[model samples]
Target chain A: MRVLGIDPGLTRCGVGVVEGSIGRPLSLVDVGVVRTSTELHVAHRLRELEVGLEEWLDRTRPDAVAVERVFSRSAVSTVMGTAQASGVAMLVAARRGLPVALHTPSEVKAAVTGNGRADKAQVGAMVARLLRLDAVPKPADAADSLALAICHVWRGGASDRIAAALEKQVAARTRGVRP
Target chain B: MRVLGIDPGLTRCGVGVVEGSIGRPLSLVDVGVVRTSTELHVAHRLRELEVGLEEWLDRTRPDAVAVERVFSRSAVSTVMGTAQASGVAMLVAARRGLPVALHTPSEVKAAVTGNGRADKAQVGAMVARLLRLDAVPKPADAADSLALAICHVWRGGASDRIAAALEKQVAARTRGVRP
Candidate 1:
């Protein structure tokens, strides 16, 4: 399946598109950023975002989309900007009839590196290694976007197994409760 | 000067427009929320945000806009949504050609309750007393938005004084260093 991943930011949105299966090396279709300027007024930024995202969507029509969710800790201003960028991403995917999945940083890392607490560097290395790229993706956001896509692809492979396991656990709980 | 405060959220955005000098409430225009459904698709939510924000802007027409910053401790999904909502608010102000001011939670509470770490209830009581409202603004978001507006109005009075004070300090430091 073809999947697109986005690392949404107010100023720079990192995006990646890849084709592959679970735990498999993904063939890179495209990677880049949707950029807006701080110099522009607020309205101008949103317009720029809309126009840019539209262009990207038209150019790279992936089957599915994966977006990083925000978990802001500080800098309210920064959070506001990141949120706007992410909103644009969601709108683009949802409008285009694409199923968008959200991944937390930890989840993305765990899917790629087999560890939830893996840092950005480790995630980047694993992403490059998995894709068999000679070098790692530059600008952590780009790597992050790639990782997110790979995680989705990898997770999709075990969908049946995962679902069955979850069902079995639920059945066990039901039996335990009733008895 | 008039200041409008906003608590931007995906489902509900709380807005309050107030006109006042430093340390006083001159006039209160309105305080309320724009609500949306979480289950609704992204496009629908975006439309709701646009219409609601536009109405708030038309009704208030304040001199400035102030928004509470979004920060996250967990769940990336939430941060993304909140950020999107905040973006809508910022875009509206920017489109209207109004400058936006941001205040941190601590800053808002410090201005209203004389304590930076005050809770929502404490701030709401003070806001009720200050705005002379019969009851606390319904929904914590509304109260928070109103409190933020009051904060800017109260502290904005000293803006000029603070600016002058900083200027004097800079001049003194320059003179001392040069001598």
Candidate 2:
């Protein structure tokens, strides 16, 4: 499946698309960032983000979207901006009927680097190695986004199957049936 | 001027529009809540909010938009949701070229109740009295949204003028001229 990963931020949102599945070699489809100027009005900055995100979605048309989950441990202002940007990404994906997955930073790191506590440099190096690139993608956000996409491809399908199984079990229980 | 006030929330977003200005009796143009089921997917919930906000903006065509600024003191999940909803409100306003103002809860309370520390009951009572409503709007979110609109009408113009003056001063200094 094709997955588009978003590392959301107000000033700069990272985006990357990867095509592959489990036990298969992944190919990079695209990687870039969407930026809004801090000098602009908050509303205008959001509008710019919306337009940029829409453009990316229309151009890539990925089957699934992966977004980094916002954590509350960050400073309030930073968290707010990141959450807002994440909201935009999710909204665009939902409007297009694309399945959206949210992975924590640690989850992405573990998926890509086999270490939940991997630092940024380690994650970047691992992503480059996994994608068989000459070097890690420039600008950490871009690498982070690519890592998110890789994480989804590696883990999202299994999670979806588990959820479906649980759902089926619930339905069967409601019907007084055993599988 | 018409002002649309938004009390941003993930599950229930309160929206209200008021028409008039300071020194004039304000009229309630509309008040309602946009709700999303908690069981819905996160992306779907955000899409519902986007649609609801777009509908309100198109219907009211308000001259300006006012949103309650989210604070970090709240639970991380709550803060994230509120900030996301606020982003949608601001983006809708920006798309239509409407100026957007963010007022803190304390600011709204102070404007309506003359006390920054005023409780919700006091703010609701003051909003009812100011709007000449038969009763306080149902749901504290709805009432708080109306109060936000009232606050903007009463204070936003002066603040806008102040911002404009500051901009002019900066421009003059850059040009090496005095007003």
Candidate 3:
């Protein structure tokens, strides 16, 4: 399944799309950053972000959207903006009826690099190697977004199956059907 | 000017509209809450909020939107959701070309209750009195949202004028015009 990953930030949001599923080689579809001026009003900045994200969504239609979950323990001054950016990403995906997945930074690191505590360099190197790129993507946010997409492809498929199975089981029970 | 105030929350968002200027008696145009199920996916909840806020914006057609500024120092688990909800509100306003103002909790309280540190009960009481309502608005979020609108009308007008004056001064300076 093709997946779009978003590393959300107010001033610089990273977006990347990858096509693949678990146990398959991944191919890069696109990668870019959406930026808004810090000098603009917050409302205007959000509008810019929404427009940028919508453009990406339209140009690169993906099967699912994966966003980095914003942690509350981050820098106090930036947490609000990050969360707001993340929300915009999710809203765009949902408006399109696309399934959305939120993966923590550590989860993405572990999925890509086999180390939950991997540093940026390690994650970037792993993403490069996995995608068979000549070099890592520039602007760490872009690389991180690709890593998040890779992680979602590797992990989200299994989670979706599990959820589907549970849903089927619940439906069977509701209908008094034997498993 | 008619102002719409939004107290952003994931499960329970407070929305209110008031009509008046800085010195005029404020009138309650509307007051209500938008609720999303906690059991729903985060993306779905955000979509619900966006739809609800959009409906309110379309119905009220306010001149400006006032959102309560989210602080990271609030409850750890709720701050992210609040900020996300606030982002949706701001986006709707910006999309409509309506001015948006963010008022901190203390500023709202001060404007309504004459004390920045006033408690919820005090703010609620003041909101009722200021709007000439028979009773304090049920649900503290609703009252807080009205207070935010009131605060923006009283404070944001002056701030907006100052900002406009500064812009004109900078433009004159660029043209080498004497003040």
Candidate 4:
């Protein structure tokens, strides 16, 4: 199964895609960032993000989308913008008829680092190591995106290839009964 | 200037559009709604919201957009979805280069009614009288949308025209004083 993960923010969003088959771990397919300018009006900035997200979705077309859930913010401005960004992301995936799951920041961190208290750099290193990447994803956004993908893989049993193995078991059982 | 307010949610979103001029109270331009399937994936719901907001924008071309600030929610799922819906709304206004302002639910209620402690029904009745509409907005969402719009108008001012007026005042005063 192929999975896409998104880490949403007001000014920047991180996205990562991975693909895997049964009995093998998921491999990193691609990663990128969606950025918006604060210098522009709030609405225009949102439009830029919407357009960018749509463009990314068109190219990737993953089977599933997993996003980092919204968190509490002291500033209403930041909270509002972040919420809007997440919404646009959900909209894109939905338009494609893909399934979406939202994971909290702690959940993504815990899945990637094996410890919920892990920091950004720690999480980034873990993501790079787990994915067997050439190097750690640059900037926090890319690494975070990678981490989201990692979380999805774990949840979806990418490490164990449960879906594929389960398919094989059912097939064998059916065959035995026929004989 | 005409302004529209939106209170985005997964199951229900309130919408109200009011047209107003300088030195006069706002009048109802239109009031309506847009809803999404509860069974649909959250991301798909956001897409529906985007399309709904887009159509609203195209038809109204509101001079400004007002949205309720997303407050903290105890339910994780609800918070996440509400945030997404708000995002879709902001994106619509941003795409059009229109100014978007946000207000808290209490602020909207206070602005519409004389008290921030007012409930939905109180706000609805006040909105009906303020706009001189024959009936109160239906299904809660529409009324809340109107409240948000009223809040923005009271606080944000007629931003599009007011900004120009301020600029002209500054220019004239600066020129005469320099001479």
Q: Against the true structure, what is each candidate's TM-score?
A: 0.64, 0.88, 0.90, 0.76
Q: Which runs of model 1 end up more than 4 angstroms from their true locations?
A: A9-12, A19-26, A34-55, A70-88, A91-98, A110-134, A154-179, B10-12, B20-25, B38-51, B71-88, B95-97, B113-122, B129-132, B154-179
TM-score-better candidate, 1 vs 3: 3
Candidate 1 TM-score to native:
0.64
Lowest summed lDDT across 10 adjacent residues in model 3 chain A is found at: A170-179
What candidate 4 gets wrong by more than 4 Å, as runs, is: A71-80, A106-122, A157-179, B73-77, B114-117, B153-158, B161-179
Q: Write down the TM-score of model 4's second chain.
A: 0.84
Ordering by lDDT: 3, 2, 4, 1
Which one wins on DockQ? 3
Task: List model 3 lDDT by residue over A65-158, tens digit each.
Answer: 9999998877668888899999989877766667788999999999999999999999999999999999999889999999999999988886
Model 3 residue A149 distance off true place after TM-score fit, in angstroms: 0.3
Per-candidate fnat, comma-separated:
0.33, 0.60, 0.61, 0.59
Give the Å error, residue B70, model 1. 4.0
Model 2 chain A lDDT-worst window of ten: A170-179
Q: What stretches of model 2 exceed 4 Å from their correct place? A: A158-179, B158-179
Output the lDDT of residue A43, model 3.
Answer: 72
Residue by residue across B1-179, what tens digits does model 2's lDDT show?
99899999989899999998879898999999999758666776777777778778878988888899987667655778888888888877766656778999999999989999999999999998988999999899999999999999998996555534443433332233110
Which candidate, 2 or 4, has the higher lDDT?
A: 2
- Per-candidate clash tally: 6, 0, 0, 5
lDDT of 1 by residue, A116-174 (tens): 99988899999888877888887888889999888888765444344334334333322
